[model samples]
Every structure is written in C-alpha cells, then in structure tokens.
Target: MTDAVLKIENLQTYYGKSHILHGVSMEVAEGEIVTLLGRNGAGKTTTLRSLSGLTPPREGRIEIFGNDTTRWPAYRIARLGVGYVPEGRRIFPNLTVLENLAVPMTRPGPWTVDKVLELFPNLGTRRDSWGRQLSGGEQEMLAIARALLVNPKLLLLDEPSQGLAPLLVREVFRVVASMREQGISILLVEQNARFGLEVADRVYVLNDGQMIHSGPARELAKDEERVRALAGVGGKEDGVLTAKPKTSAA
Candidate 1:
C-alpha cells in the first residue's frame, strides 16, 4: 500500500435519512486505470463522491496520495491532486467552452485551453460556444479536458461513456486510455461493462451496493455466467434489484 494513490478502507457513507455504501473498500495504485463496474444505481457515483469528499464517508477513511483527508471539505479534497468529472457531463451550461475549461484551474502546469483544444480539435473549433450548445459527446470531452488542465494526479471519472453514440464513446474512451499513457492514474466508474473491461487493468463489480466480484478486467469479461447473473446485464430480471442509489459502506 506504500505506492497507493487513493485508498478507501471499510468506508461508509449516507444521504440524509438513507444509508448507501456498506463496508466498501478499494484502492487505486499509482498510474493505473482501475474501474468500478456496476449496473445502474449500484453506488458507483456515490463511491466517486466519497473519494472526492463531496459526500464524506461517515465512517472509515479516505486517503489520497498517502494523505488522510477523511474530514476535509470537497474543495480541500480537490486541492489534494484529485479531480472529478462527474456523470451527466456537469459543465456550466451558460459558460463558453473556454470559460468552462478555466473554471477549475488552481496553479495549472500543463493543461491550458490551447493545449486541450489541440488534444480535442473539435472542442477547439467550438471554444467560443456555450456549454449547452455542444452535443453530448462534445460536452463529455470538454468536461474531461477541464479536469486534466489542473494537472491532477488522480482522476475520478463517473460514467464517462453514458449517453453517447458508439463513435463518440470510442472517442472518449480513447482519450481516457490515453490518460494512462500520459501517466495519470484513473478511478473510473462505468456501466458499460464491455468497454470498461476492455480498457481497465483491474475492475470491481458492485451489486446491491456490495463488492460481489473482483478480478482482472479480462477475466470478468470472459465470465459469461457471472457477467449475466450477478451483473444484472442478462438473464431473468431480479426483482430485488432497484435503481434508487443510496450511500453506505460496502
């Protein structure tokens, strides 16, 4: 664990009156693409939120780059070399592309507007356009680029492939895959098992807010029965499975 970039030990989280995660613990090693794979509402987003301290786990601990920041505020956690690109591509709808990309800059060593545009030329072409003006794919690219501009050591990505066409999904995943090549560690939460497993070095599957499966991405991809049964992707529907996500320890 000496080289672990992010660590969660028996973490528990809550949402007002509801409990969500249940003794959940995981780790992201430095410069690796590790994904949390789950069905919709399997506490994937909440896990990312807890890691980023947006919703701090009520129990257990969160460590970023070996520093304990369990009680830190979201901004403080963000300042600890962690950047999160949330689900739904939560960019500022009213801001221009340039404005959105610049909103999260702290000291900025490498990720500049010109540089991000160079990486994503389509976004460069729409630099002056409003956030809402871009398509879903374009907005996702913009959101990710904005996070990278801060030179974050660990990136928490929630459902980066959601709601995009196959072509755009490929485009975004390629960008994510490239982040590892650039030596940026990633903790990705994704529902697209196929693509998630394809790029991930390691993966964890969450079911009913519990860690039911853990293995190399390739192994999980090959287990058809497990993929269909516990994953909620194939076979008879399980009535116990619900879409309302809660925060708890898993």
Candidate 2:
C-alpha cells in the first residue's frame, strides 16, 4: 500500500439511480503513470470522479498512500494530495491566469506560482490574462498548471486531450510524461488509446462500468488489433484507432 500512490478495490459509482461504474479496481504505483482506456461513456470519467470524491463510490474501498479515503469528500480528498483535472477545463473564468493558480494553494509543498509558470511558459506570458481570454490549448495548460500547484502526490486526469489540435495534444501528453519524471503519480482517463499507451506505464481497460483488461502499456501497444478492438475503433485509417500523433485534450 505504501508503494502505491492510489488503490481502488471493487469501486462502484452511480448517477442517481443509474449505475455507472461497477467493480472497478486499479492502482497507480509511486511515480508511475497509469491510464484507463475505454470508449465514450465507458465509465472512465466516473472512475476518476469516484477517486476524486466528486461522486463518491457507493461501494468498495479507496486508499491513498495506504490510508482509507473511501468516504472522503472532494475537498478532503484534494487536501490529502489528490489533484483532479476534470473533463472540461474548469479554470475560473472571471480570474486572471495568475489568480486562478493562486486559488488552490491550500498548504503548498514545492509547487509555487513561479514553478507553475515555469512549467507552462505560455501561461507565464499570459499571467495577467483572464482565463476566458485564453485559447482552448492555453486553457488546458492552465488547468494542468493549476492542479500541479496543489503539489499533489496523485493526479487524476479525465480526458486530458478531449478537443484539441494535433500539435497541442502532443504537447499535453509531453507535459504529462514530464510530470511522471518529476515523481508525480498519475491516473489518466483518456480516449486516445495510442497516446495513452505511449505515456502510460500501465494500462487498464474499462467497459460498461467494469475493468475488463489490465497490463503493461508496451504489451498492449504491440497488439494494434487488440487495442483497436478494445477501444471500439475500426482500423488504423480511423484517426481514433491509431494513437499516431503525440497530441490529445480533455
């Protein structure tokens, strides 16, 4: 448990009376990037939400650094060093980029405004720009920068590359890879199977609210047919089938 930054056992989540995630279980080891890959509405986001306490799981256990956090609230989970960047870039639209970075500094460790800016030079240039004024790519970088400011031990990213240009997606995945190099464990939920496999150390496949596959990323990448089938994409010609480019968005 100490070696794992996060561990979930048979996690189950729901939206009102509708069940969304069933018996979902996975782990992110220290300093590793673990990705959850699946088609749309395959419970990827719900898994992240449950772990982040946005929608607490109705059953199972959530352990962070070996401590039980199953019933913890969002804020509590966040304070425990879990930084969550949800599907949509949720920066404060009314605030400046700098202001947005300052909003989540609860009890900071190594992450400072200067550090965050250093990681995102684009944001540094637009330090005083309003969040709403930034482009989609810039907004995504800001969202990731803001999460890093929390100095999280475990980062939960939901669709980090949802809607972005090809180049921007590559840049985003590069940053995610850098985070792992810096010793930040990440649990990524992404639709781009190729990109996810490229950056992830391990991979888990979720379908219809349950995890159906789990293994090393390299192993899955080698079997293109299996990857395409699991992701529900048809072939290499389909842009979604092959994670050809380095880019992605949330």
Candidate 3:
C-alpha cells in the first residue's frame, strides 16, 4: 500500500489468559477506507482496541503516521491524530449535544464544532438536547461528531451502523464516505457486511482470530456467496478464500 497512514504487522493480543488475535495484520492507506468484517467474537473489536492503545498488543509492530507506537499509551496515541469511535456510541448521557461535542481533546485541523455540526445537521437541530434524549441514530451521529473534534488523520470506527434502521445506516455511511474526501483515512469495524463492502475501498475478513481474505471491496462484493462465506454474514458460512491479488493477512 502507498502512503499508508496505519500499519499492523503480526499482531498478537490477549485478554487475561485467553488469546484473542493471532498474527492479524492490516493497513489503511492515506485517504482510504478499509473495513474489517467478521462474525461476533472474531477478534474484530480487539484489533481496534490494540491499535488505539487501549489494549497494547502482546507482540507486533504498530505504526501510525510512520511512527513506532506499539507501546504508547491511549492518550498519547490520540495525540498522534488518531480518532477512535468505539462501539455502543459512548456518549455523555448527561451532557447536551453541544457539550458532548466540546468534550474531546481537540487538535489543529479542519474539523471543528461548527463544521461537524454542519456535516451532521440532524445533530445541529438538537444541539440543546441531552444525549440521553437523542434517538439511536442521533446518538451515533453525536459519537462521530465528538470524535471528529479531535481533528484526526486516521479514524477508527467500530460498528457505526449497528442497531439502526436501513435509512439511517445509509446516512452514517454517507457521512463516512465524505470523511475520505476530506482526507481522513478510516479503519472501520462493521457488522453489516453489505454496507461495509459498499462503502470501503478495501476489505479484510477475519474468522476465529485469523484473517481469511483481503482484497478490493468491489472484487469481493461481486460474489454474494463469497461475501457471506468469508464474512459469515446472514449465517451462511461456506467456501474458503482462494488466492487473490492484494490480499492482506489478518
């Protein structure tokens, strides 16, 4: 990959006595979107956590913006222009929309309170509303908006489309696509394989803590059977990933 904003090599991580990720590796090029697809407990979230420094890898190399950050703390990693939007839309329920947006430790960049509000106008209308009062879509939007305030070069999004209506999912993806145009590389963990394949430039599939396939999103999206097989989406697991050009080891 050219101009890679983030790269992980032979990553191995664990939780207490349980080994989770097994030599999983992937990269996100500058201004590109790379989606991580897998069934529940495929070590998808663990990968993001490791990259964000919330859970330092047991072994591996993590380079962000060409810096060796394998042992950096979570706050230090955030300072390197990496914005992470974790699963569950972790917002300050007691804070207003405006307050929640203002909470992130910001950096010097184009993403500001007003700019993100403009990008997510639904949030703008409810600026005075408490986060707890917002709908699920609104909460998700708020979460994304809060992360953008960090003015990151790379964004890590975990399940941004989970538990939302079909139309809302499209809206979330549309916003995500727009971020690429603004030059923010994204590493997205998405449960909805179809949406992940549709919006991402490249795709990585993980099964049982191992990478099964990596290729162009368009290439994999062409075969519905292959998508379901590699990702286990819709619960129909079949077929193995054959040799494909540009495949990144998971």
| Model 2's TM-score against the true structure | 0.92
Local lDDT at 10 for model 1: 83
Clashes of each: 12, 12, 1
Can you write out model 3's per-residue Cα lDDT over 1-250, one digit (the tens) per residue? 6699999999999998799999999999999999999877899999999999999899999999999999999989999999999988998999999999989899999989999999899999999999999998999999999999999999999988877777888899999999999899999997777778889999999988889999999888788888777876731222112211123234
Query: How many residue pairs clash in model 2?
Result: 12
Residue 171 deviation, candidate 3, in Å? 0.4
Ordered by lDDT, highest first, the candidates read 3, 2, 1
Using all chains and alpha carbons, the TM-scores for the candidates as numbered come to 0.91, 0.92, 0.92
Error of 2 at 66 (Å): 1.2
Q: 1 or 3: which has the higher lDDT?
A: 3
Residue lDDT tens for model 1, 79-117:
777878998889899999989987985645666778889
The lDDT of model 3 is: 0.88
lDDT of 1 at 104: 84
lDDT of 2 by residue, 1-250 (tens): 4598898999889999999998989988999999898877889889988988889999999999878999988888888888888888888999999899889855568888898889889999999999999998899999998888788988989877777777888899999998887788999988777788888999999999988899999999888899877875322453442342334233
Error of 2 at 78 (Å): 0.9
